[model samples]
Target chain A: MAEKTLSEVNERIRDGSVRVVTAEEMPSIVDELGPAGAVREVDVVTTGTFGAMCSSGLFLNLGHSDPPIKIGRAWLNKVEAYGGVAAVDLFLGATQPSIDRGIEYGGAHVMEDLVSGKAIEVEAEGVGTDCYPQLGLETTLRLEDFNQATMVNPRNAYQRYNAATNSSQRTIHTYMGTLLPRMGNVHYSGAGVLNPISNDPSFQYIGMGVRIFLAGSQGYIIGSGTQHNPQAGFATLMVTGDLKQMDRRFLRAATFTRYGSSLYLGIGVPIPILNERLALSTAVRDRDIEVPVVDYGVPRRDRPSMAKVNYEQLKSGMVRIGRQEVATSSLSSLLMAREVAATLKGSIEKGEFVLTQPVAPLSLAGSARPMKQTKEFPYVEDVMSREVVSVTEDISVAEAAQAIIKSKFDHLPVVNSAGVLCGIITTWDISKAVADGTISQVSQIMTRNVFSTTPDQPIELAARTLDTHSISALPVVDQDGRVIGMLSSNHLSRLFAGRRPR
Target chain B: MKLLLRVAPGIVRKPLIASVILETGALVNIERASIDAVSGEIVLDVSQEKCRQVKDALERLGVDVILLEIPVIRDDSECVHCGACVAICPTGTFHFEDWRVVGEPGRCVQCGACVTACPHRALRLVLK
Candidate 1:
């Protein structure tokens, strides 16, 4: 049976008789020796992943100031930290961008700087109270200045994630990295066979209180992470560790162009080979795992999966998607993952780290649920102006100008004789026409390319349309292609204002 | 040596690269080119001795010649040979050899893709 327990493994580790191998080496060792023989020979198989995790942060307790201010608002290195917790405790989310540097510098950078032993600028404001009289604070402090700085990541080390590609005309900057236009490139995350959860798919060995290597520090899995969907193979883990013990090599800050900030962290989990099942599980290879190739161009809740590819194909640096060979990139660093795994293995073999069985197994029943829309008016039809004032294309510039002046609308939709939207003209266009007396007909000055929306579309889509085109309004049309209403930015602003409670 | 030539809209239609080769007897190996009727940019490889002659010849035709000399600088101390820059480099500048990243700095066209994609901040773009 070749069975062992956590305590047995720890005893072997302490006695300098433990055998530890990295996930990369375990599969080959399993091939040389079957699962039963492998279990007898191997004590632990270490797995690791280094990728951008946005849902990671630091919980810091800055000891009370001399005046004893309760920080209502706080900033670390110009990046905002959540001050909604206790009086002195603050949570700095990795993805929160700096007020001045935007995505270039953020909470992730602050965390890295802290790990690098650099000084951080702190600014806080507090509401004055009898016991805590200080109203504002401005000071500089290092990572050691805080009473406690703990790394409490919410969701990390996804079991498996989809590869991303773009089918649109332009490049999209996503958390997956820059997906080139027309499937020019593919970006996939996850450390494949080297991922901890991937090695233990059913959560048999990984659960609450499982010890792990988080950013080069000893960490523990607190519970199933947020959006942990084991059914879909996208399981996640929530972990916590001491920030001061973390190494900068395993912690970094990254910025996706057009997207926001994220923390690049390394996590390693050592699986004690307790039995044949655990031994066989650690032998999973890159070719054994498959993930969907999601199209980032399709902006929706459920994006379309263009194809399925194994990690081997992704690691080969190219994958075929609909007859096109796309160059593939990995958002997670495999080299770093290997380094982390090797480091963990060395730590275990050196008897510096020991294994512990989880007190409670993680729950794999719940599925990830999309946020339900609860707004009173979610569609463009609910907020659009019903009485739209439009002019036919044949109308003179003077007549269109008169209608716009009388209606006091900045934009006027120009329609064909059959009442189909043909063009649009703004007050600025009319003023340009008036300045240059050559324009007589509305068609001469009216912009032929008009951006419009549909009545059945969601208000967010309409808002996106207006925002993407840099326009203040969109003519909402029906299924028959007739302008039924106008959705102006003013209407959207008013809708938001009306929805807000006074 | 690698060079990035920005041909003006007015001179994009001219056979500039052909002219430079014909005039100086230098070989121009174009690495990448995106040319249209309006304007064009070309990345080409040439010998070190011939690079100065080519640049002078192109500059005489009002073409903007930028000598791409070590455009992307790799900090060996920070780089872990992650290969994160390998798949995104349009010119295949960084590649894996024995499971470690190797950089061919001459092939890079200064796109800055690898610079941004690098997780360790090990690569930087120093345009000279």
Candidate 2:
């Protein structure tokens, strides 16, 4: 019997304490020899999902070696348990609900490592990856267990020498999977593409101190930072570039190697009371660290006590770090440049970057195109008279009544010769005049001493006036009391409705 | 940290062998893909080394399993567009492409998503 038959019989004996039957035996059992032709019924599948309640509060200025972000005991657990750069895979089940979460902003340069036609490639050995976007900056990265070893970029043909044949040949092909999270800003992309259709006109310019959030299910982030080469089994570290300019400032460069690579990771947040920020970089290698490089380095990177690498000195010539210049010979100056770049992009990364280039300040979205609103109060002007018609004091009852009927005007303004408005003749006034008949003119029946406003008066105040008087119109005039235009109840409603973009 | 893939008990492990039970009264329901419900009996097949591993893994993940002793049929053709194979496979591992079918073993819950996705009786899930 097949090995499968043996296992099936073992389970059968365990479950029913009966003799094992073979495929041939299934015939007699099904044809009436055994209990066979029976109805089978099953139920729906209940998929299981586990949820996590993660909380963390990190406070520190990352560059400061003197201090680090304040992570309380309770919050520390979050960093150790719930936090850390992680890869997320979402399986869209047949039935799922909508979710929106904040973005997970990360360092720039991610696209350089992505599978774009733009990624630069070269050939190397032992398999490693490095990127120094800027020229004279020094930066380091600390990562925990990645999905793979080495940082091989697929563009480089992976050729390992065959010892037996003594010749080099390609080994494997690479594939990319979803190893990083994705977010859509609607206005700016990591690639720095600005789409102008999604902004508010009132504040066409994105202002500073804007608290940015992303779209997705809670805990899902958008800033992308992971890349994997399945063909070579290597995962590349990605960085962020100005989504508008496509430039990276904070991180100068990165290097990935096999074996128990270098380690030292920290998060920084600023603190006002302490007048200092903190940095906590963990290390994988037991290397000696100097407390300060002030004598050799100054300016922005100068700190009384810092755990930093001197790229300028190192790059000037191979510096000796315990008889081993080779160990750290390849350090680049990009890290230092990255620090400067980060400072410049603080506003951009925070979504505070001005969309327009200047002169004609533009918005990231096109909704903010400039337009003009009426400046005159009795804005409702009669084309024939070249005169204002509103709700204040101006034309006589006979003239106003005649104007209303002739112009088919729903609103007539009362104003002074200086063009300032006093009151308005509305539909109600006309109704009363027609009802009283004894008036014979508009002033005799028109409502007087009604709500009026000046040119500088806020439109919101005009709305309140209409609401308070329970009136449908208000006449706007100048300081000289000259009739301007009529603020209609319908127009005010339309403005408020148009304020929100669909 | 080590991640031990745990299989569930109520889920099916042997979607490949469901074809052997074609004449049975029970029909493989496509929508009920997550759960493994057998009409009369469950059938399955796996290499000796992977048998217990696959079974235990599926069990830990909370998937159901059925044992069978039937052979599999592999005909690059004649596998009519049968939904039978898709119904049998709990894991939607098999994707119908323009040229032919592609199987991602790593993604295969081994529960058989494609088994039930098929419409014809071209495939089988034997115990061999």
Candidate 3:
């Protein structure tokens, strides 16, 4: 049981005599040399994960304007940034969408633009004070214009995350990405074997003030991330780094379709091989780690888990859910994760970065709890019939009529060539077509201006829309205008009666 | 070169793809076909040099032809080659080559699946 401390590893790194390997490479090395041999040979194992972390943001100290008043509100490139901290300081949240452009552009984009050396539009309003009388200021500011730009992410790396799938009849857009219907695809985040927190699951070396890599910049672990549920194996990290020193290649602003905006940044951490136990932990492989496959179609906080799958199956590009084989995609970039780990390893080998002992160990006691709700008002998704049957616009009127009859539904939503919502055909429309002796295509008689509702909309709103339009049902659509389900008045009445429709 | 051919209801039953291969001597790889009584849409791949000939041939058969030109555009500045597109593409149009995502535009059928799957918002599908 060979043992070494962080100071010993730092000493080796300083002398350019440290042996470093990536988390991906550590598994093979441990198998060849065994845990004891690996402890003797390897000084550090670098781990990395590059993924969408919506809870990440930046703390910027905008240099004081002339006669600056106490800032009450701030907007960076039309995306709102919180200015409650101080007179010249603001916190730019990555998930904040633009007030005008919405999710198409956001705080994440502003942060990326600033880091890319693009001038950002900064607008602030302040109430006039006795000492500082400036009311409002609108100016363009670059990353260099700020006195200090630091990334203080409340949640960064997750030890492991469940893969997402959709069991509902229609595709659902979520933070996990677009989940195809009936388990058509599995979307998973986290770098698995290359994950920093996963490699150091017990948080032995990772704690407060641990030196690490953050988006190609040197950073430190501040504390445990919010919702740090260690017992469920969902450990997270809160980190801080010099945002001005980060590389644009490792930092990106992203929009997840109907979900909202998120930030994708690279993070890597070095684990010192203190002993055989530490070496064994670093050598954990993708096959050894198992995560649940959660069905996001439920649209609930505690979505049902369909199955338990490992990273190996997920990375292999497909996973089995019941009797069907579903394709899998990773929202986290393993390629970029690999690059982060390699870069960190090179930095340590070149004596540019050194390991540091944690100032305080992360607490392992706290768990996440759901927010309490006063009333349970159902959304369109809760009452809508997910098993929707649709027909293509090119289908003949006779075929559309047959499909509507067979499905026992009066309305049949017509989709275009790309499966986007185009029109809706009703039994009455089909009957009129037959009586006219022009029973050609569904496009002839189908309602082109059909009203629709989203899954997240309140059931009351959906009911109002239906009543306003004088329609029996409203097709539930995604952001891309694709039909996912049907929300009929009958379903709402059933819900009101305390009975859920199948 | 990939193409999306929209055949009118009058010519929907005809073997226009066979005629294109026979007349222009171009190799046509039919990737996907959705046809009904009203209209038909076929996605096919052909050589770059023979693309013009194939389009002209299909047009002569009363088929509306569109030469698919990068249906899914990956913004190099925004894309980090994360492999989300590679895994979600049903046709396997995108693959990892040397740690970077390489797209085979000829294989893309304009499903727009990758556009939604891309977390970076780097990929966009443009269908004119």
RMSD (CA, angstroms), candidate 2:
33.4
Ranking by TM-score: 1, 3, 2
In candidate 2, stretches whose alpha carbon ends up further than 4 angstroms from where it belongs are A1-399, A417-419, A437-476, A486-502, B1-128
Highest DockQ among the candidates is held by which one?
3
Q: Is candidate 1 or candidate 2 better by lDDT?
A: 1
Worst 10 residues of 1 chain A by lDDT: A493-502
Better of 2 and 3 by TM-score: 3
Which portions of model 3 show Cα errors greater than 4 Å?
Answer: A376-502, B4-42, B46-53, B59-72, B97-99, B124-128
Across A237-274, the per-residue lDDT of candidate 1 in tens digits comes to 99999999999999988777678888989999999899
Which candidate, 2 or 3, has the higher DockQ? Answer: 3
Segments in model 1 whose C-alpha atoms lie over 4 Å from true places:
A380-456, A471-502, B4-22, B25-50, B59-66, B76-84, B116-122
- Expressed as tens digits, the lDDT of each residue in B58-81 for candidate 3 is 888889988788777888988877
lDDT tens digits by residue: candidate 3, A1-502: 7888888999999999999999999999999999999999999999998888899999999888898767889999999999899788999999999999899899898988988999998899997888768999999889999999999999889889999999977777788887778788898888889998888788888899999899989999999999998888899999999989998888899988887898998999999999988899999999988999999977657889999999999988779988888888777788899999999999999999988889888887657889888898888888888888899988899898789977646899988877688889888899899999966988788898888889998898788778866899888999999899998889988888999766
C-alpha lDDT of all candidate models, in order: 0.88, 0.27, 0.87
**lDDT of candidate 2 over B9-126, digit per residue (tens):** 4333544324322423233322223233532232333455445555555454454554322223334332322112321233444433431344444333333323322222233444
What are the iRMS values of all candidates?
A: 2.4, 25.5, 1.9
Measured on C-alpha atoms, candidate 2 has an lDDT of: 0.27
Candidate 2 residues A1-502, lDDT tens each?
A: 1112223323433454323221112223333522212001100000001000011111111131112222111111011111122111111111111121101111111221121123212111111113212212112312211122112111111011000000112111001000111110000000000000011112222122211111000011111112222222211111111212222221111111110111111111110010000000110011211111111111111213212333233223223322323211111112222222233224333333222111232222222123355663222221112234443343455666667776434777665555455456766677776676776555566555766665555566567667866877666665666655556676665565663211
